[model samples]
Target: MSENTQNAPRPIDIKLHQASRLLEIKFDNNTECMLSCEFLRVYSPSAEVRGHGHGQEVLQVGKEDVNISAILPVGNYAVKLVFTDGHDTGLYSWDYLYDLARNYESLWIEYLGKLSAAGHTRKNLS
Candidate 1:
């Protein structure tokens, strides 16, 4: 339980755009962000995606075609995202979402760098 979780802005609206493969979220603090489904799937905050400890992350590949199939609310704190690729474990917390939105560009760049270094490419799931 992070301190930001206690004060983080809640989502005012959440829209899923399947055609564009993005999740648009508007927060109460007037901060809005469009998170790509591929981004969310690769950055999922689950043990399966992130692993159990630092430096243990299993790099996600072939997620360029991922999309949100469903979004289920988790109490008052988070949302469970069900991805089109059959992944349904990550719980996106409000604070986490805010952080992701705020740091999206940098995080994405970093992810790309990692993928390149590992000789992996994001591909359409067929």
Candidate 2:
């Protein structure tokens, strides 16, 4: 494998906190991050979320109460997240998850800014 692939971070464990709607990921390098379900939903890597090309992105709303229903392994490289709202296309690789953890604060702020700009609010999904 390539050096970049060889150095990719691996998840050691994943814990779901249903009540708090948080997914805690522990990495092999001893780093851990607690990601909100809403964040994951909004930042989904699926085609529906990302769209077909640059600037074609679609904003996701009303996912504040979204929760991961299941996590299916896609191989040694990635895992597919099945969300409560029936979105299951995104295959989150280890590198992508690590990047999400590293950039959570900025990404979340950006998401909120976009939502505000679009006059959208997080509604109850339950």
Candidate 3:
């Protein structure tokens, strides 16, 4: 196998916890993370959220309660996340998902900062 293929992180397990609104993922490299649905929705890789270029990202709001409705496999490389809010465009690749998991803390903080800068307050889901 090529070095790139050998180094690629693959998902060993993926589970969606509906009640807690978290997506738990374990990678072949022994990395594990629980990503919140809201986080995933806001950081969606779709053009609708990420836009067509840099500095064109659209801030996502009111997604505190969003949950995964379905997890559809995309060949052998990725999964199509069907959100409860009807968003199903972003294809979450193995690498992308691993990145998200590893960077969850920093990414979530950045997202919150952006929301605050936009004058949007995130509602308490509890």
Query: Which structure among the candidates has the greatest TM-score?
Result: 3
- TM-scores for all predictions: 0.92, 0.90, 0.94
Candidate 1 similarity to native, TM-score: 0.92
Cα displacement (angstroms), candidate 2, residue 29, comes to: 1.4
Steric clash pairs (candidate 2)? none
37-103: candidate 1 lDDT, tens digit per residue: 9999999999998899988999998889888999999998889999989999979999888888989
lDDT by residue for model 2 (10-68), tens:
99998889888899999999989999988988888888998988899999988888899
TM-score ranking, high to low? 3, 1, 2
Worst 10 residues of 2 by lDDT: 1-10
Sort by lDDT, best first: what order?
Answer: 1, 3, 2
lDDT of each: 0.90, 0.87, 0.90
Candidate 3: count the clashes: 0
Model 3 misplaced regions, further than 4 Å: 1-6
Which is the better candidate, 1 or 2, if ranked by TM-score? 1
| Residue 101, candidate 3: C-alpha displacement in angstroms | 0.6
Better of 2 and 3 by lDDT: 3
Backbone clash count, each prediction separately: 0, 0, 0
